[model samples]
Target: MTKLTLSLAIGDYDRARPLIDGRVQVDGVDLVPSVLSPEETFFRAFRHAEFDICELSFSSYTVKTSRDDCPYIAIPAYPSRAFRHTSLYVRKDRIKRPEDLKGKRIGLPEYQLTANVWGRAILADFGVMPSDVTWVRGGLEQPGRPEKIALNLPPEIKIEQAPADKSISQLLSEGDIDGILTPRMPSCNLTDPNVGWLFEDPTAAATEYYKRTGIFPIMHVVGVRKSLADAHPWLPGALFKGFQQAKALALDLLADTSATKVTLPFVEEQLVRAKELMGDDYWSYGIEPARPTLDAFLKHHHAQGLSSRLMAPEELFHPATHEAFSV
Candidate 1:
């Protein structure tokens, strides 16, 4: 009869909503949502032992390096490429080809994100080393403070802070940065005549890498306290079910324009983006952490010196609640 409080970082809520809103109810559990960005929520929860279940970015876990006594059971998210949505977008006027990026300034939200990692890998694929380009940081550019997630930066990396008054988009428009490594927002377009898709296809190298390595660097994971999981063993199952329900709801809504009309603007945008990137498989239930993808991530982490040793997939994910639910 006791309720389980789950805290998830802000952007993560879309993925966690099903468990909180739908799945827990069928198992006679209650989930409460707490709004916080992944880093703030993670540190707060870890410091105060605040929530029963939570979600945090994998970069956060690697950067904090404070897993001891942490009650959270790390769960694999639905397997997807590490840089699924992130990419290196260039301006067509400046860079006629990916090779042309060799000496350009690249803008990143932060130097520590998987987006940067993937960007580096993509550059490597194009034969452009880190020394070949200038790295610029601090690109969140909206009118508010940036989210506090760990950037997973190496000691040697220097982050250039952007001016507080200017947004990254504004800089991009003004030609301050040659290209940016970030997700494409609705207002942004790779084919906009101004901006060019640098890699042509961002996932090509990743797909090949997946075939070579069986691990995928997981970007985000759902974490729940071990004690909470022990006390409420049904929580994972319920959470999974909730996600399934949410996926269904999202899909149904996507199908019916009327339903999407009621959702948040960002959520609607995310749904559209999800469909465009992931296709029909986006709504499938359960987490499917791609091993090959994680392996590639480990290599990048080591290359960047973010981690000395690669974490095994088992070390990263909690044991499956059941075979059917395993990802």
Candidate 2:
């Protein structure tokens, strides 16, 4: 067989390091992987279609997919996932609870960011809809950042671009915005006394939310170029199997007790607690395993005016990735 050669751009995550280092290889394919930061990878991929396969923001992916002009088709291999409770930063004196956000100004890097969508969904659960808050969109640390993809938001949803000279984090620090939905913690929260998390204990709040909702929000998915997938129908499944094997190896390394594979202490304890809370395959990657999270995100994406319509969870993934042969 003539192995297909392709370029892949994804975050330098432990779960994907095996593929990057060639410990795991996609069957019938030769990968030239670039381990880039998620922000750059998403921007280049969505804007220019620079790579044969890449990591994509789920929100932006859905927006393009719903428009029926997306350049790539995703597999169920989620490269990034997190609970979004920790993604929200607020003024301690102003936004004490989720409801406090109603009618307030909120700053975010982009209206179509996956983390912000999940963060807004958290507010919606508290009876605050997207329309209830005014959103200021801009870069988080630097000025002039734009949405990776265009969004056709509903008229009722309000989003304004921040001043060309300032970033969203600057707006939060200056008290121009009541709160912020961010993929990363803002430097203002570290230096400013008034900036804090709405959830006093984000970990506890996220755990409680998970217990109630069974959702581990997915941030990024792996996408193969549509032209490539169409030319080689087997590509999606090959990449899927490669990622699963890589993840299993990463988990095994984490479970090893002799020396912690990660820099964090109490790796074993955290691993044990995670399995207790979410089961053995907590960070599972597949349509069936991730349906609840996917469904919730799709609903929120549409409600927040990112998706053209409410998309089925399965629609985001390639058909070859929907199921695998069991022997």
Candidate 3:
């Protein structure tokens, strides 16, 4: 039998390592994986439809799917998940709390990014609305970042593109911007004492957030070209199963702490603590288990004006991926 060979674009994630290295295989499919930064992967996938399967930004995918004209279909296999508490960085002396972020100039790599969406949602937790901030959009470390697709947002939201010559990092370093919301650590924060996390200890905030919301935020989902899923109805579930198996294998290896596979210390203790907080399957990818996080994100997407309409979790995934037969 000939396997369906498809191109897959994803980030270099521990969960995806098994699939990337061929330790886990998608049934009846041969995926040609292209591991790259989330920005590059998402940019190529959304802008040019460059991959048959790709790790996609949940926010942009929500925007596209809600239009009823998206070219792709997603499985609930989230390749990236991070608590947004760490995504906020502020000038050490300027913004002391989330409330201070209101009416302040906040720099972001992209206005519609998943990180920013969740960041805004958390800010709302402290009484800051999306419309309250004056937003500056630019690359994190480079210049000239633009929205991948057109945005039809509410008039009240304030967004301005940074000057073509300057990046968000540059603006933050020069104290031109009060804070930055980015998925990665800002370049200026590493070497400068003046730039620090909005939360001094993000772990505490994340723990508190988990206690309040019971949500470990979902970031990226795996998408296939809708046309491909339409033509080959079996593909979506097969790929989902493959990704699940890949994640399972990765986690199984992580459980083996006798010799310490990862370079970081406290691997065992951290794993135990995470399970204590988030349960056994902490990084779950199933539709049933992810409903709350997905629901919360949909609400945020709508509230932030990223989506033209509120999207239901049921409508966001491929029909073929909704269920699986167990043996």
Which candidate achieves the best TM-score against the true structure? 2
Candidate that scores best on lDDT: 2
Error of 3 at 12 (Å): 1.8
- Candidate 2 residue-wise lDDT, 42-139, digit = tens: 98998899999999988888899999999999999988999988889999978888898899999998888899999999999999999999999888
Ranking by TM-score: 2, 3, 1
Local distance difference test, each candidate = 0.57, 0.91, 0.90
Write model 1 residue lDDT over 61-91, tens digit each, in one string.
5444333434566655541235542366777
lDDT of 3: 0.90
As for candidate 2, its clashing pairs are: none
Write the candidate numbers in order of decreasing lDDT.
Answer: 2, 3, 1
Candidate 1: stretches off by over 4 Å: 1-17, 23-28, 34-51, 65-71, 79-86, 129-132, 143-158, 163-165, 184-193, 199-219, 230-234, 241-289, 320-327
| Worst lDDT 10-window in candidate 2 | 144-153
Would you estimate the TM-scores of all the predictions? 0.67, 0.98, 0.97
Error (Å) of candidate 1 at residue 87 is 3.2
